[model samples]
Target: MSERKVLTKYYPPDFDPSAIGRTPKHLRKQGPKVITVRLMAPFPMKCTNCGEYIYRGRKFNARKQTLEEKYLNIPIYRFFIRCTRCSGEITFRTDPKNMDYECEKGAKRNFEPWRDSKSGKYNETEEETLDRLEREENAEHEQQERDKMAELEEKMHDSKREMAIADALDEIRTRNARIARNEGKDDEAALDSIHEQVDESLLQAEREDEEAARKAFMTANGERIKRIVEEEEEDPVPTAAPVSAQSKPAASISMPPPSSTSFSRVKKTKKSGNLLGIKKKPSLV
Candidate 1:
């Protein structure tokens, strides 16, 4: 067999390449060989092997593959990618439960804590629910701290009240003790003054009685002596006067001799007169 060669190359001025016929819209067009779907990646990713960073919102030409897993009657899909630097295989899958693409292996995404947003109510996702749960936990913790602080404050207030009451009681006790001491001193002073007055009155009464007795004794002695002398001069050698038996027995007399002389006994049958009164003395003249 010989290789045949032919050549005729020319372009007409009226040729329009866009005039070619295309398939009708109603007919089913052939599907593309490279199936692509937009993915939402809200965080940066780093390759596990090469530590290469893939920034957020980056576009990647990933090859799609079917997964055996199914959720809620929807078939799961997987995508395989390669690291730009190391060309290491990276893979991710669609998560129907969380409604986001999850890295199956070979890469790590920056951790992002969940939070609620303005559109969370309309287009709520699993992240929104997680955010609500986190908020509830935080609120519970704050409430607990507030309760502990309130309890501590109450204890402090009670302690302050107790201290105040103790101080008051101590002050009252001291005041009562001082008052009792003053009263005791006053009683002692009063007792001493009363005792002194009583002693002085008793001494004064005793002195008055002694003076009256002395005066009475002196008066009686002078009168008795003068009367005895006159009676002796007038009744010298006079006979003794008679007296009642009861009165004579109750009386006796003793006197000093004025001058020495002889004396005679009276008759035994006659009763003696009161000797200290005006009795006659028998004299030897």
Candidate 2:
């Protein structure tokens, strides 16, 4: 047989075990009430599945079960209600400590994937999602605007380069035109100078020819005058003959008449200053 164990405590020696059934008057004095929890049977008022309003005093033979989860220490009560109208079965659960009820099918006692621990609700709403999409769209639009600005700058650069090239071409063309004009002017001036030279040469040649012809005429006239003077110097000189006395000199002669009239010729003579027969007298003499 198994032996029974006895417990002893320090108290009055006259204490009896039967006296414990009666409470003391001073201990029975009322004090502040305390809150306690109780798990009671479900009310028989309404079956959410059956849609039948069962009377409060009536008894319902409903099935009850205890559901437990790893995160919760308290047991949950599950009630299965059967509908008399459509024979539909509905289950309901209750948290005995909290006195909270939930539909068995719709009860979300497990870990919710959509809820956030901080906000205590599901994910972002439709408005928030739309706002995010709009923000992304605006960012893309800004990027496009930046690209357009860059493209415009490139086009402007090209335009400036092209404008500069066009200006340079115009300057070159203008310079060339000016040079051509100057060359044309120079050519005209050169032609005029050549004409002036040609005219001067022709005039000089005409003057020279006239001078030569005048000099030749003078030389021929000088030769003819020299020939005439030389012929005159070579001719012989003539003298007068003396008159005879026989014919007419009887009266002119001083002497008597010659015997038997036979006349004797008398001679006359003249003297020159030079012996070489060249003239020595001056032109004035």
Q: What is each predicted model's overall lDDT from 0 to 1? A: 0.76, 0.62
- What count of clashes does model 1 give? 0
Question: Which residue runs does candidate 2 get wrong by more than 4 Å?
Answer: 1-123, 187-285
The weakest ten consecutive residues by lDDT in model 2 span: 32-41
Per-candidate RMSD vs. true structure? 30.1, 42.7
TM-score of 1: 0.29
**Tens digits of per-residue lDDT for model 1 on 1-285?**
233443554669998756868756677475533466655444578999989998887777778777667987898888877788999988888877767777888899766555234545435666777898899999999999999999999999999999999999999999999778667777778678779999999999999999887677666546422333444445567676786565665446445676544465555765557754766888989
Residue 224 Cα positional deviation in candidate 1, in Å, after optimal superposition: 99
In terms of TM-score, the best-performing candidate is 1
